[model samples]
Target: MDTPTEVLHRVFGYDSFRAGQQEIIEHVVAGGDALVLMPTGGGKSLCYQIPALVRPGVGVVVSPLIALMQDQVDALTALGVRAGFLNSTQDFAERQQVESAFLAGELDLLYLAPERLRVEATVRLLAKGEISVFAIDEAHCVSQWGHDFRPDYLALSELRELWPEVPRIALTATATPATHAEISSRLGLDGARHFVASFDRPNIQYRIAPKSEPKRQLLEFLRTEHQGDAGIVYCMSRASVEKIAAFLVDNGVDAVPYHAGLDSRTRAAHQAQFLREEGLVVVATIAFGMGIDKPDVRFVAHLDLPKSVEGYYQETGRAGRDGLPATAWMAYGLQDVVQQRKLLTEGDEAHRRRQALHLDAMLALCETVGCRRVMLLDYFGQQGSEPCGNCDTCQAPPESWDGTVPAQKVLSAVLRLKRERRQKFGVGQIVDILLGKQTAKVLQHGHESLTVFGVGTELGNAEWHGVVRQLLAQGLLAVEADYGALVLTDASGDVLRGQRQVPLRRDAPRPLRAKTAAAAKSRPAAELPQEAAPVFERLRAWRAATAKEQGVPAYVIFHDSTLREIATLAPSTLEELATVNGVGENKLAKYGEQVLEALTA
Candidate 1:
């Protein structure tokens, strides 16, 4: 039998394993259960794939998405590993052929949707096959508190009940300590050996700017730094998705829209285009990117605030999967906080409280005056990470000032309106009242007569907006769910009573032109030396044609990183090309001659 290292090189074309992989692979190959928490691009798949190859029988993998399963199987098949998947997208004949292959021990890996385990026929089919390992991809979905929870995953514990002796490995790209514990408890892998990799992705630069003209801001961001790059733009609503997509397209970006409101066929087509094409941007809601396997997504921009930090991390982690430089940029403001808080006010008290905790953490991350990466890692219970120099905070630190007077003025306006006038007003009226604006609404409502009117004349309109946003983030100000009117929380009373102080973050003024970061100015992952650039482009052209003929994404044929290495090395023969990091024996045998010709041409 081939050892794990042998399988890794012979099939997957890697000389060594990444951190925490070799031990986990050997443990599972020795028939031990494991729960792995690795980052998105940290190679979690190899932990199971290598063990499956080294072990005796077919590996059964439980995946959550049909696209993910198909992508995995295609990539595996390209590596000469016999891989297949059964999902709703497959017709009966196709499913039967895959099932027959599994039964006859001709397949190394077989991917199944979590929902498929509910079928009696699938259970019988699994029983009939000689199984090696059971791998659960995206195991965080089993947690009720997780961002991407799937009810079908709760039934996965039965895998242990049905096959007690077969080894199982559960893996995910994002999870908090609490969610990690829940996954273990719910999946009945309480005693499984746990592997927690570092949650940091240094290749992704995190930046958040105050929202002004958000659509224009997004366009400027794209045109300035990320022009013609493949990316995903996340919006909070379907209307925003459509508008943003149209706006981008009008501004000469190759863009598409995806949302749950769209029909399944349209969504599938858009997703396929995103996977298959280059330099195309997709504007979407959170529904768009859960199991996306695209490796070269250069950035993930959020036009609205994410409900939680986990969601933000997972979405941004999609970029730079090839270990290249990428950006995680967001345009956040007071309305985002108001909308998210209003959302949290629904459901029962317990659910509301849970959601409030999530929102509070998210707000803290946004409002923090310190390092963004430090707070992000700290949230996942991984500590001792210094301030990473890659985020907005570390690059240009925001100032924290004593905003007690400003906080008092804002709260006093809300207080007097509620107590004296029996009225509540939204941010616009509150800002106007503070700035002493005698606009039509203020004059009509007689808010100009309030004592707090004109109290905030020392600060400009934008600075006052910053004050209100920070107040809302600190929970001293709350938004009424129905009308988005500013209301005082219990914490507001302490600030007004002089019993507490408010230290607010003073954001740097938005520059006329955004100064691109040093990291953003670096070359992309696929970039090569001047002499090798033409060779890389030729090889890419060949890969595009081959993948088009096969009806698979270009990365499934050969990742850009592999092509770059090949272009630099300029190997002449299959034996020499096989030594490249991503050139497995199967790939070298299939495409080596063509690659050599591309090099010469």
Candidate 2:
């Protein structure tokens, strides 16, 4: 049996395990259960893949997404692992072949969707086979409260009951304390050893801007920050996904949309192109991005507010997976909060309250004046060190000014309008009254003779909006169910009485500094030296052609990161090339000669 370290290099082509990976692997290899909470691109796959390889029988991996299973099998096969997947996508004949292989014990890992496990036949087949560990990927899907809940995943807990002897490992890329606890309980892994890695992705620069003409802002950001790079643009709705995708394509960008509304074939084709092609942008809804394993995603831009900080982190974590410099940019505003609130109103009271809390956490992250990384990490029950210099706040610290007076004025306007005038208005109306705008609604409400009237004229409409958002985020204000009127919460009285001081981030779009811009434009290290550039391109061309011929994503042949390593090292012999990270035994054996020939050519 290959030790975990030996398998790490010989199969996965890594010199060492990432933090917490080795320990988790060892625990699983020793037939112990584990629950791993690592960030996206944090090598969560290896914790199971390696253990599966070292263990005796095939590791049964339960993934939630069919697309994910296909990609996982393809990548693992490329690494010389006998991996196969049985999902709805396969034909009857294909399914038979995989089943035969499984029964014959010719497979090391088998990826199955949770729905497949519900079938009695499938469960009985596994019972007859010599099973190894049971690995559940995206374990958070078991949490009914999570953003990406799948009913199919709920059926997975049966595995623990059916095969209690087989060790189980549940893994997820993002989970909060509550969600973490729920995952453990739901997956029947409550007693499993827990390994929680740092939630920070330091390579991803986090930036959130107040939404104003979001399309225009997104276009400018793409042109300036991510030109000729592969990325994802997340929109709140399918309509916006289609519109933005069309707009991007019209502007000479290679972009496509992916949403739940689209047919599965269309979604699959678009996703395949995104994985195989370089510099393609997929404008998508939250329906996308659960099991994406792309390593070189340069950025993830959110065109609207995510439901929660966990959702936001998972979506943005898709970028910089290769441990390269990347970006997490978002555009949000008061409207996002209102829209989310309206959405929650449709659910049951308990569900609505839970969603409201999640939204509040997300809003607080956006409205915070401090470091975004720190705020984001803190939400996930992790303590962050000094401000991460990679985020927008750390890059160009937002101007913070005393917002106490403005907050008081905003809250006073809300309270007076509700109590004395017997009127409840939206945030816009409140801001209009505060900014002294004598709009028709304000005029109809009678002369603005209130003490707070015109008192906030020192701030413009936009500035006042910022103050209101901050107050809402800080719990100083709340939106009453009565016509969505802003109401003063108990916390508001402290600020109104001068007992609390509010600090608001006066956020403005700071032009990308030349240094930052250059860093943003920096390519993978393999493309840096002039000599290696041509070689890197050559290797990419070869990989692309091979992938096209094989009908698999190019990354399956060799990830860009791996090709870059090969290019930089310029290994002239097969033996020398084998030493490059990501050059696993199977890939090296299959492509070593061709790789060396490309370098010489």
Question: What ranges in model 1 sit over 4 Å off?
Answer: 510-522, 525-527
Output the lDDT of residue 6, model 1.
93
* Model 1 quality (TM-score): 0.97
- True lDDT of residue 272, candidate 2: 90
Best model per TM-score: 1
In order of appearance, the predictions have TM-scores of 0.97, 0.94
Question: What is candidate 1's CA lDDT for residue 461?
Answer: 88
lDDT of 1 by residue, 65-125 (tens): 8866777788899999999999999999999999999999999999999999999999999
lDDT per residue (tens digit) for residues 1-601 in model 2: 8999999999988889989999999999999999999999888999999998998999999987788787778888888899999999899999999999999999999999889999988998898898889999988888866778888988888887898889999999888899999999888888889999999888888988788999998988888778778999999899999999999999988899999999988999999989878789999998888888888899999988999888999899999888888888998887777667657666788888888888889988887778899998888889756788777777777888888888888888888887888877888888888877788888888737777777777888887887777776766877765477777778888887899998888885574453334544557643457778788889988888888898788888888788888888899888888888888888888888888888888
| Model 2: CA > 4 A from native | 448-451, 480-484, 493-500, 514-522, 525-527
Q: Lowest lDDT 10-mer window, candidate 1?
A: 517-526
